[model samples]
Target chain A: MFYDRDPWKEQSMKSRTSLKDVAREAGVSTATISRHLNGSLDLPEPTRMRIEAAVSKLRYHPNPHARRLSLGKSDTIALILPDIANPFFAKLAAAIEKAAERHSSMVLLHATFNKSDREMAALERAAQNQVDGVIFITNRAPEAKVARALNDFARAVILDEDVPGGKVPRVLCDNGLGGVLAGQHLRAAGHRHVAYFGGGADLHSTQTRLEGLRSGLAQNGEPAYEPTLFVGDHSPTSGRILAEEFLRNADQETAIFSGSDELTVGILEVFHERKIKVPDDFSLISFDDARSLHLFAPAITSVRQPVDQLGERAVEILFSDAWDQPDFKALTERMPVELVERSSVAMPANKKKRPEKQL
Target chain B: MFYDRDPWKEQSMKSRTSLKDVAREAGVSTATISRHLNGSLDLPEPTRMRIEAAVSKLRYHPNPHARRLSLGKSDTIALILPDIANPFFAKLAAAIEKAAERHSSMVLLHATFNKSDREMAALERAAQNQVDGVIFITNRAPEAKVARALNDFARAVILDEDVPGGKVPRVLCDNGLGGVLAGQHLRAAGHRHVAYFGGGADLHSTQTRLEGLRSGLAQNGEPAYEPTLFVGDHSPTSGRILAEEFLRNADQETAIFSGSDELTVGILEVFHERKIKVPDDFSLISFDDARSLHLFAPAITSVRQPVDQLGERAVEILFSDAWDQPDFKALTERMPVELVERSSVAMPANKKKRPEKQL
Candidate 1:
């Protein structure tokens, strides 16, 4: 209850000259003064001098927390992600940091390591801190409780993957398009039977991408077989386990579409240890080319997420004034994905091993 | 001055039944209760029950910020680093976060991008927030003003590289040993004329490692040539520029010792684009094997920094009770490094190209 009203807000309000007071004395909009103080704007010399004079007269030091107190903001954003060790999330954090700095906001990081309890704990802490906004990223299919907590924030954005029950603005890469690109690439290379490796079977990304893969494989209304699904968490350990299982149970799968680079690392490690050569033994494609995939032993081809754009857009949405609109909180923006072609994908060696009509 | 005394601390103290009250009721030390509440200690059944009973009777909820007020601490640590997008720093942050959680503390991240002004700003912000501790990391040789600012904190750590005048505990990788390993490896491969690509000419790491390289190269009283030095910041862009300069001005250098993996990425990019081959055109070794070096195009050899150990130790020292000791503030811990042998190092192809007895 001590955090219900930020204690700093109450103390600073009674002592400091507020931003509203400064704006009134300077005969300018509070927005203009804020933008100028944050070094995000340039005004006419006369206007700037007038604001400076007003600031000097009032002894109004624009401490970010104190200034933002008048606006009921924290000047901080809580960034909750599955793991920062993952290159994708690290890059996302960097972009978000850069974007937030432009608006004079700092990021507080909470790494949940894909645990449900940790996710809830981080959300609660964010709420207690009264952060101005929140950016939630999860690799797993989160529980409805997690979504409900996220919805309680004044401003929150779901990023990278989907949270099924969340009624907040969402920014995600086009996973369906990523799957279509992979399916078409594999199909063009004379591969019919493929395996889809995904993080979670119940995840929105996994389902959407799977449907798109089915559509892609069924070129010109031809009979399309559902690709074999291998479900695991988006981690290297899970990838290793799934790779081993796939190797043992293989019947006619010729190529593999890995859900993430984390899994690809595990699959590659297993392949290298067991002397199973990529493309020579099985053609492979990876998603989220956040790592230096181009420098890998066999320059991997991957679906590259627009990481910078996604991060910048998420922060932009969090700070945007459009939140007052009726449907703004329900908005979902999907960024485009691109395929980076390299040596990892090739014509499958077992092109002729499978029968044409196996039905 | 607003944060001179934490406002939350004041508010929480007046309203809540303190940890001291619980300790008094349970007939146990505050330390025991603190550790128990953080779930860091296992207690005997009777003692645990008594503590639980006392907690319930007093309605003493151990909210982290409120509970820590009694101990004159914040349940937060400020992690200031150069860049989070870099794999080495990202991995370091992950380790620090894991270690902090063991003691029920949270990490607040500040990425400075190796800028002096930003570093000072982050430190000032940490002081304002009255964080429990600070972990400062900078890649280049920092200004003296930066060191002075760091010295103001009661519990601050200098990590990775040195701050010239900071009177505080430090935790860094053994740069000398890393250089020795690289030098010895190259010497055994019959390379005498080597190049050292360093982050900065005046950086403590660069100087220490350069001395070690000289000593290692002079094996068994043999004459050691002063290796060529290519000075640049630890970044891919800088690496590319330095690599170009090294190539253009090479006289007899047959190998390179890169400062960090960030530089290696840039050098490798340049090499790949220029059709130069690792260990063929030039043998090379990189520092900070944080990236997937074993899976590189040539499987790069690198001196591996003990990143996890360094992070864990920094946090441990920050929370350690040794701070009251007279000499504790001057303590410095250097973690060991090892060379990861891979395909990147080989006997130089220009073995016979250099003239013997050039002097």
Candidate 2:
């Protein structure tokens, strides 16, 4: 196969000079040369100069594979996310890659698609490759084993959402605040009853956002009613399914807070098909405004995550010198999010009297 | 400091068995064992069983680094792309990653962001890593040196846009066909004078699409007018600039064939800001329906690239056994594109007679 004669093999064969050759010419042990080259040893000036001259004379370059083996570092970070095709995650990956580059590191991407087995496999592979660190992003609430696997890494940052038992620092958008903003906006627009469409009820973001929604809906000392919950994965398909259920079982709910733009797309698709008007029949607000929501049919109202900042901060935290600090691993950095007001939200429709039941 | 004690290093230290250990135990040469493990050597059943038993008894595991050095294959593919943040590229990458996984190969992503230096650097890094193959994707026309660097790879598949000097298999959507579809759609709607928004005039896609557009616009028994070209990089910002330029220089062009949805977003933004209506003021058609175009304010008419097929085919070719064939390197696979009709196109507006020259 052509791969058998690859440049690495050809170069190795063409250039026969090895560390032993340099050591022989420098009149030093191979160990000394290896240690010196890897910066693990400090030799006298004359000896160092002799080794350098011999290395230059031989034109010997250290094998990267061997160097990696010795150093136990790959100069790479692994980005484990749900799906790379998802615009939100794609944008996040781009930002993480850019930030990793600034630190002279490359990113190895793994799209688990929010699957547990895939997540475990990706983590194991990252460990096997001895990556410098990992930035883990999962949409679903992960199993304990997944958290354990993540914790096994020397450095890993849980990003976008939380992992229940993950000991690593987390960088996430303020989901509660996002919910609060959405709730306040809905309440101000004269919406009292609303539904929260979430990925999973157990997800930290979902719980926080729901809590914030309740708090924000409370107006002028009135007791806040818990918004109805519709749980599904953070996908457009799930959005479609949830939207259907919402329509079929809607009970005076006048607004909805979609968990992600992905779901929002699904909801809108069904609505558009069914001729359900937005802000008239139902007001909506989506999270993770990563898509071109501004160009949507009615110009979607959304709670915008600081995606760029979240990704950048995750990488920064992974590579930070403060990893050795006692509280660093337990730290959680919640970047702020803001509500983008567009034409999607409006006052609820006029109440209609219900007819008496007839069998 | 934590990197130095990575689990791989710890494991390596705990298990000192090498290929030599297994070879000695099996009474076979190291080369035989290596070749057997790599599936390069066919051995009798007894010998194979003996080797397996020896390996298990000695608990010998091949060092991935050493194995890579010996085989000259990294079991990894490098995907060099312009940008991952772009939906088109992101979708393409997702498909490629999924396909590559089927072949038990991992993808190392490199986002060059359409820079010559970055392209060169990524290629060099891929070479250094001894990747099994490379899938190169660029938006702009690359310099000859970049092509040369790409050519140096044992196997590379030029994807999406063309690299003129690259001597490798290519997998790209039929840009000319896409243009023709758009042009025909517009021409049918009574748009004789049209404009093209391209990434760059020198780009292969741009030239091919322009050619197709000209052909499509020239219907039977009708004269064809060359569409005015507004060139810019495939970005929303560029779209905005080009739209402004098109407006400033508007003569009689009644429609636009935007190169990509990225550009379409920018044009729409500018048009929205200026209170211009699509299909009312000017008909429009966008290329690369990777974004959620269906939900756009006025669902955009676009040419859809077979992104999934393009990505899957690229990986299939990369790993195919046909490399030894003489014609394989010269292969160019052009996936067909389809025009997705929506409400964005309409008949040209009735012309208002210009005021008689009073000057």
- Residue by residue across A148-258, what tens digits does model 1's lDDT show? 888877689999999988999999999999989988888888777889999999999999888878777778889567799999998889889999999999778888999
Stretches off by above 4 angstroms in model 2 are: A1-62, A351-359, B1-63, B351-359
Residue-level lDDT of model 2, residues A110-196, one tens digit each, is 889889999998887776566788999999999999998888777899999999999989998999999889999999998888999
How much lDDT does each candidate structure score? 0.85, 0.88
Q: Quality of candidate 1's docking, in CAPRI categories?
A: incorrect
Best by TM-score: 2
Per-residue lDDT of model 1, residues B129-206, tens digit only: 666679999999999999987887778899999999999999999999988899999999988888999999999999
Off by over 4 Å in 1: A1-72, A350-352, A356-359, B1-73, B350-352, B356-359
Listed in order, each prediction's TM-score against the native is 0.84, 0.89
Candidate 1, position B7, lDDT: 25
In Å, residue B15's CA in model 1 sits off its true spot by 15
Each model's Cα RMSD: 7.7, 4.5
Considering summed lDDT, which 10 consecutive residues are worst modelled in model 2 chain B?
B5-14
What range of 10 consecutive residues in model 1 chain B has the weakest lDDT sum?
Answer: B1-10
